[model samples]
Target: MMRSILERASHWLALVCRVIAGVALIAMLGVTIVDVATRYLDRLSDGAVAVTLLGSVELVSYLMLCSLLAAMAANVEKSQVVVEAFSHGLSPGFKHRLQGVYLLGFAALGLILCLGLVDSAAAAARHGEVTQDLRLPMGPIYTTAAVLSLLLGVRALIHALLGALFGAEGEVSHGE
Candidate 1:
């Protein structure tokens, strides 16, 4: 019963993350298109309007970061990468153990990244850091990214535990 609840929760969380990432990606694409179009228009008009999107670079950077962080949990859940070359001849049991170890290591790395991001966010908050043009506070963005990193760590740890206990067959489905 508990496992089922956890599985459902994880699936829902992954779906949310994927959706957020997709939105961020679309926003970035739109922003880039507008920026480019405006630049072209400015050139065509010989600087008559001098139109340019303010803080576009900063906004896109933040959006890209958010998208990457948000997608990470889903990617980890899906095991998106497959490197069969190294483990081609390995037995299924051995491969499962190896995968478990890899997932645990990834969890540890995520934890470290989350801690560092938290510290960075705190420092940004304390220093009143802001982007050059938009004066947008970076503390919130960093904090959000840190939270996503923590979620990724939790997901990795869960996968590691499941793999260790039940081999490759014990996967938590993300509702297909």
Candidate 2:
């Protein structure tokens, strides 16, 4: 029962992350289009109607970061790149073990990255770092990124455990 509940929660979390990523992507596209249109209008009007959105670059950068970070969990869960070239001839059990080891390694790497991000975020907060154009605080953004990284590490670790216990073939399914 507990495992079932945890699985459900994981599914919902992955879904939410994917949804957030999609929203961020759409927002970034809209902002970029508006910024470009404003630039074009400014040129046509000979600077008479200056309408460029301030801090657009900063906004876009934040949106890109959000999109990338938000999508990471879903990507790790569902979009793992498969390369059959190297393991084509391996037996199923061997392949599963290999994949389990690889996933554990990936989880370790993610943990390291998460730690680095945490340190970076603390430094940014201490230094009062902010975006140049918008003066947006960099600390919160870095902290959020660190949270996402931590989530990715947890997800990868879960996947590794599943693979190890049940074989890669018995790992979590997409269900679609």
Which candidate tops TM-score? 1
Residue range with the least summed lDDT across 10 consecutive positions in model 2: 167-176
Cα TM-score per model = 0.85, 0.84
Pairs clashing within candidate 2:
none
TM-score between candidate 1 and the true structure? 0.85
Off-target runs (Cα >4 Å) in candidate 2 are: 1-6, 91-94, 169-176
| Clash total of candidate 1 | 0
Model 1, 1-176: lDDT tens digits are 54455566667777888898999999999999999999999999999968899878988998998899888876774673547888789877666656767789778877888999999999999999987789988799889889888878877777676657555524454321
Evaluated at residue 29, the lDDT of candidate 2 is 98
Please, what are the lDDT tens digits per residue for candidate 2 over residues 1-176?
A: 54454456566766777887899999999999999999999999999989988989889998898888778865665545557898788777666666666677767876887898889889999999998998988888888777777767777666665556555533245421
Error of 1 at 10 (Å): 2.4
Clashes per candidate (backbone, < 3 Å): 0, 0
**Best candidate, lDDT:** 1
